[model samples]
Target: MDLITLTGLRVRGNHGVFDFERRDGQDFVIDVELGLDLRPAAHSDDVADTVHYGELATRLAEIVAGPPVDLIETLAQRLVDACLADSRVARARVTVHKPQAPIPLTFTDVSVTMTGTR
Candidate 1:
Protein backbone atom coordinates (compact mmCIF):
# COMPACT_ATOMS: atom_id res chain seq x y z
CA MET A 1 0.00 0.00 0.00
CA ASP A 2 1.07 3.55 -0.66
CA LEU A 3 1.13 6.19 2.03
CA ILE A 4 -0.28 9.69 2.38
CA THR A 5 0.55 11.44 5.64
CA LEU A 6 -0.79 14.61 7.21
CA THR A 7 0.94 15.86 10.31
CA GLY A 8 0.81 18.75 12.76
CA LEU A 9 -2.84 19.58 12.27
CA ARG A 10 -3.75 21.72 15.24
CA VAL A 11 -7.27 22.54 16.35
CA ARG A 12 -8.93 23.85 19.48
CA GLY A 13 -11.33 21.45 21.17
CA ASN A 14 -13.17 21.00 24.43
CA HIS A 15 -12.18 17.47 25.33
CA GLY A 16 -11.14 16.31 28.74
CA VAL A 17 -12.32 14.75 31.97
CA PHE A 18 -12.13 17.99 33.94
CA ASP A 19 -14.90 20.58 33.91
CA PHE A 20 -12.46 23.44 33.58
CA GLU A 21 -10.91 21.77 30.55
CA ARG A 22 -14.26 21.48 28.84
CA ARG A 23 -15.12 25.06 29.65
CA ASP A 24 -11.77 26.58 28.76
CA GLY A 25 -10.91 24.28 25.84
CA GLN A 26 -7.41 23.50 24.58
CA ASP A 27 -5.53 22.90 21.39
CA PHE A 28 -5.19 19.40 20.04
CA VAL A 29 -2.55 18.41 17.51
CA ILE A 30 -3.40 15.53 15.19
CA ASP A 31 -1.46 13.39 12.76
CA VAL A 32 -2.96 11.01 10.21
CA GLU A 33 -1.42 8.42 7.95
CA LEU A 34 -3.48 6.72 5.27
CA GLY A 35 -2.42 3.64 3.34
CA LEU A 36 -3.86 2.92 -0.08
CA ASP A 37 -3.05 2.28 -3.68
CA LEU A 38 -1.71 5.44 -5.25
CA ARG A 39 -0.74 4.01 -8.61
CA PRO A 40 -3.96 5.15 -10.23
CA ALA A 41 -3.53 8.69 -9.04
CA ALA A 42 0.14 8.69 -9.93
CA HIS A 43 -0.56 7.48 -13.44
CA SER A 44 -3.65 9.51 -14.12
CA ASP A 45 -2.52 12.60 -12.23
CA ASP A 46 -6.15 13.00 -11.10
CA VAL A 47 -7.08 13.66 -7.50
CA ALA A 48 -10.29 11.69 -8.03
CA ASP A 49 -8.24 8.52 -8.24
CA THR A 50 -7.16 8.90 -4.63
CA VAL A 51 -8.18 10.48 -1.37
CA HIS A 52 -8.49 14.26 -1.31
CA TYR A 53 -6.28 15.21 1.65
CA GLY A 54 -7.50 18.80 1.85
CA GLU A 55 -11.07 17.62 2.37
CA LEU A 56 -9.85 14.93 4.71
CA ALA A 57 -8.04 17.52 6.82
CA THR A 58 -11.18 19.63 7.03
CA ARG A 59 -13.22 16.61 8.11
CA LEU A 60 -10.61 15.71 10.75
CA ALA A 61 -10.60 19.25 12.09
CA GLU A 62 -14.36 19.06 12.43
CA ILE A 63 -14.08 15.82 14.33
CA VAL A 64 -11.55 17.31 16.71
CA ALA A 65 -13.57 20.50 17.20
CA GLY A 66 -17.00 18.85 17.17
CA PRO A 67 -17.90 17.28 20.52
CA PRO A 68 -16.39 16.91 23.95
CA VAL A 69 -14.87 13.50 24.57
CA ASP A 70 -13.06 12.61 27.77
CA LEU A 71 -10.37 10.51 26.21
CA ILE A 72 -7.96 11.27 23.41
CA GLU A 73 -8.19 7.58 22.53
CA THR A 74 -11.78 8.12 21.47
CA LEU A 75 -10.75 11.09 19.39
CA ALA A 76 -8.01 9.07 17.72
CA GLN A 77 -10.45 6.29 16.90
CA ARG A 78 -12.87 8.79 15.42
CA LEU A 79 -10.13 10.11 13.18
CA VAL A 80 -9.16 6.60 12.10
CA ASP A 81 -12.79 5.85 11.30
CA ALA A 82 -13.03 8.93 9.12
CA CYS A 83 -9.93 7.94 7.19
CA LEU A 84 -11.20 4.41 6.66
CA ALA A 85 -14.48 5.82 5.32
CA ASP A 86 -12.72 6.41 2.05
CA SER A 87 -13.01 3.26 -0.04
CA ARG A 88 -9.51 3.72 -1.36
CA VAL A 89 -7.96 3.57 2.08
CA ALA A 90 -6.80 0.16 3.27
CA ARG A 91 -5.40 1.28 6.60
CA ALA A 92 -5.26 4.33 8.78
CA ARG A 93 -3.24 5.52 11.76
CA VAL A 94 -4.09 8.54 13.87
CA THR A 95 -2.35 10.34 16.70
CA VAL A 96 -4.03 12.87 19.00
CA HIS A 97 -1.77 15.15 20.98
CA LYS A 98 -2.76 17.06 24.10
CA PRO A 99 0.08 19.39 24.98
CA GLN A 100 -1.67 21.15 27.84
CA ALA A 101 -3.00 18.11 29.66
CA PRO A 102 -3.79 18.59 33.31
CA ILE A 103 -0.78 16.75 34.60
CA PRO A 104 0.72 18.25 37.70
CA LEU A 105 4.24 17.65 36.52
CA THR A 106 5.85 19.41 33.62
CA PHE A 107 5.66 17.47 30.33
CA THR A 108 6.26 18.16 26.72
CA ASP A 109 3.04 16.55 25.53
CA VAL A 110 0.51 13.76 25.91
CA SER A 111 -0.83 11.77 23.01
CA VAL A 112 -2.83 8.75 21.94
CA THR A 113 -2.26 6.78 18.76
CA MET A 114 -4.73 4.39 17.15
CA THR A 115 -4.59 2.31 14.00
CA GLY A 116 -7.33 0.61 12.00
CA THR A 117 -7.75 -1.34 8.81
CA ARG A 118 -10.72 -2.07 6.52
Candidate 2:
Protein backbone atom coordinates (compact mmCIF):
# COMPACT_ATOMS: atom_id res chain seq x y z
CA MET A 1 0.00 0.00 0.00
CA ASP A 2 1.17 3.54 -0.74
CA LEU A 3 1.52 5.93 2.18
CA ILE A 4 1.07 9.67 2.62
CA THR A 5 2.62 11.19 5.72
CA LEU A 6 2.35 14.47 7.59
CA THR A 7 5.19 14.67 10.07
CA GLY A 8 6.23 17.09 12.77
CA LEU A 9 3.00 19.09 12.75
CA ARG A 10 2.97 21.20 15.92
CA VAL A 11 -0.09 22.74 17.55
CA ARG A 12 -1.02 24.20 20.91
CA GLY A 13 -3.75 22.52 22.92
CA ASN A 14 -5.06 22.25 26.47
CA HIS A 15 -4.92 18.64 27.54
CA GLY A 16 -4.09 17.01 30.85
CA VAL A 17 -5.44 15.80 34.15
CA PHE A 18 -3.95 18.50 36.33
CA ASP A 19 -5.77 21.84 36.72
CA PHE A 20 -2.74 23.72 35.49
CA GLU A 21 -2.53 21.50 32.45
CA ARG A 22 -6.08 22.33 31.55
CA ARG A 23 -5.56 26.06 32.09
CA ASP A 24 -2.16 26.19 30.40
CA GLY A 25 -1.69 25.21 26.81
CA GLN A 26 1.22 23.17 25.49
CA ASP A 27 2.77 22.29 22.16
CA PHE A 28 1.58 18.98 20.73
CA VAL A 29 3.20 17.40 17.71
CA ILE A 30 1.18 15.11 15.49
CA ASP A 31 2.51 12.65 12.95
CA VAL A 32 0.03 10.98 10.67
CA GLU A 33 0.43 8.15 8.17
CA LEU A 34 -2.35 7.45 5.71
CA GLY A 35 -2.60 4.53 3.38
CA LEU A 36 -3.82 5.02 -0.16
CA ASP A 37 -3.64 3.52 -3.60
CA LEU A 38 -1.55 5.93 -5.65
CA ARG A 39 -1.89 4.17 -8.99
CA PRO A 40 -4.84 6.30 -10.12
CA ALA A 41 -3.27 9.56 -9.02
CA ALA A 42 0.06 8.61 -10.54
CA HIS A 43 -1.52 8.00 -13.90
CA SER A 44 -3.95 10.93 -13.85
CA ASP A 45 -1.68 13.33 -11.95
CA ASP A 46 -4.73 14.73 -10.26
CA VAL A 47 -5.07 15.70 -6.62
CA ALA A 48 -8.65 14.45 -6.54
CA ASP A 49 -7.41 10.92 -6.99
CA THR A 50 -5.21 11.08 -3.91
CA VAL A 51 -5.41 12.25 -0.34
CA HIS A 52 -4.79 15.89 0.54
CA TYR A 53 -2.40 16.41 3.44
CA GLY A 54 -3.20 20.06 4.12
CA GLU A 55 -6.93 19.48 4.35
CA LEU A 56 -6.46 16.49 6.62
CA ALA A 57 -4.18 18.42 8.97
CA THR A 58 -6.61 21.31 9.14
CA ARG A 59 -9.45 19.02 10.18
CA LEU A 60 -7.32 17.15 12.71
CA ALA A 61 -6.01 20.33 14.31
CA GLU A 62 -9.50 21.72 14.74
CA ILE A 63 -10.67 18.64 16.61
CA VAL A 64 -7.56 18.12 18.71
CA ALA A 65 -7.25 21.74 19.79
CA GLY A 66 -10.90 22.11 20.67
CA PRO A 67 -12.52 21.65 24.07
CA PRO A 68 -10.96 19.85 27.05
CA VAL A 69 -9.66 16.34 26.87
CA ASP A 70 -8.19 14.36 29.74
CA LEU A 71 -6.45 11.69 27.71
CA ILE A 72 -4.34 11.62 24.62
CA GLU A 73 -5.82 8.23 23.80
CA THR A 74 -9.20 9.83 23.29
CA LEU A 75 -7.68 12.45 21.09
CA ALA A 76 -5.78 9.86 19.11
CA GLN A 77 -8.91 7.78 18.61
CA ARG A 78 -10.80 10.84 17.50
CA LEU A 79 -8.09 11.62 15.01
CA VAL A 80 -8.18 8.06 13.77
CA ASP A 81 -11.90 8.46 13.22
CA ALA A 82 -11.34 11.63 11.27
CA CYS A 83 -8.65 10.00 9.17
CA LEU A 84 -10.74 6.98 8.38
CA ALA A 85 -13.72 9.13 7.52
CA ASP A 86 -12.03 9.87 4.24
CA SER A 87 -13.03 7.10 1.85
CA ARG A 88 -9.69 7.26 0.13
CA VAL A 89 -7.80 6.22 3.23
CA ALA A 90 -7.45 2.49 3.71
CA ARG A 91 -5.50 2.68 6.96
CA ALA A 92 -4.18 5.37 9.26
CA ARG A 93 -1.89 5.85 12.24
CA VAL A 94 -1.65 8.93 14.43
CA THR A 95 1.00 9.91 16.95
CA VAL A 96 0.70 12.78 19.39
CA HIS A 97 3.74 14.07 21.26
CA LYS A 98 3.78 16.20 24.36
CA PRO A 99 7.29 17.59 24.36
CA GLN A 100 7.02 19.68 27.50
CA ALA A 101 5.58 17.13 29.85
CA PRO A 102 4.91 18.22 33.42
CA ILE A 103 7.04 15.52 34.91
CA PRO A 104 8.95 16.37 38.05
CA LEU A 105 11.96 14.70 36.49
CA THR A 106 13.55 15.79 33.26
CA PHE A 107 12.68 13.79 30.14
CA THR A 108 12.91 14.08 26.41
CA ASP A 109 9.21 13.77 25.51
CA VAL A 110 5.93 12.00 26.14
CA SER A 111 3.64 10.72 23.37
CA VAL A 112 0.92 8.33 22.23
CA THR A 113 0.37 6.41 19.00
CA MET A 114 -2.86 4.94 17.69
CA THR A 115 -3.63 2.88 14.58
CA GLY A 116 -6.84 2.34 12.58
CA THR A 117 -8.03 0.82 9.31
CA ARG A 118 -11.07 1.21 7.09
Candidate 1: where are CA atoms >4 Å away?
A: none
For candidate 2, which ten residues in a row score worst on lDDT? 63-72
- Candidate 2, overall lDDT? 0.90
Tens-digit lDDT string for candidate 2 (1-109): 9999999889888988888888988888999999989899999998888888899999989987898698888888988999999898999999999888789898998
Per-prediction TM-score, please?
A: 0.98, 0.96
Q: Over the stretch 40-96, how does candidate 1's per-residue lDDT look in tens digits?
A: 999999999999999999999999999899999999999999999998999999999
Return the top candidate by TM-score. 1
Q: Rate the local accuracy (lDDT) of all candidates.
A: 0.96, 0.90
Clashes found in each candidate (C-alpha, N, C closer than 3 A): 0, 0
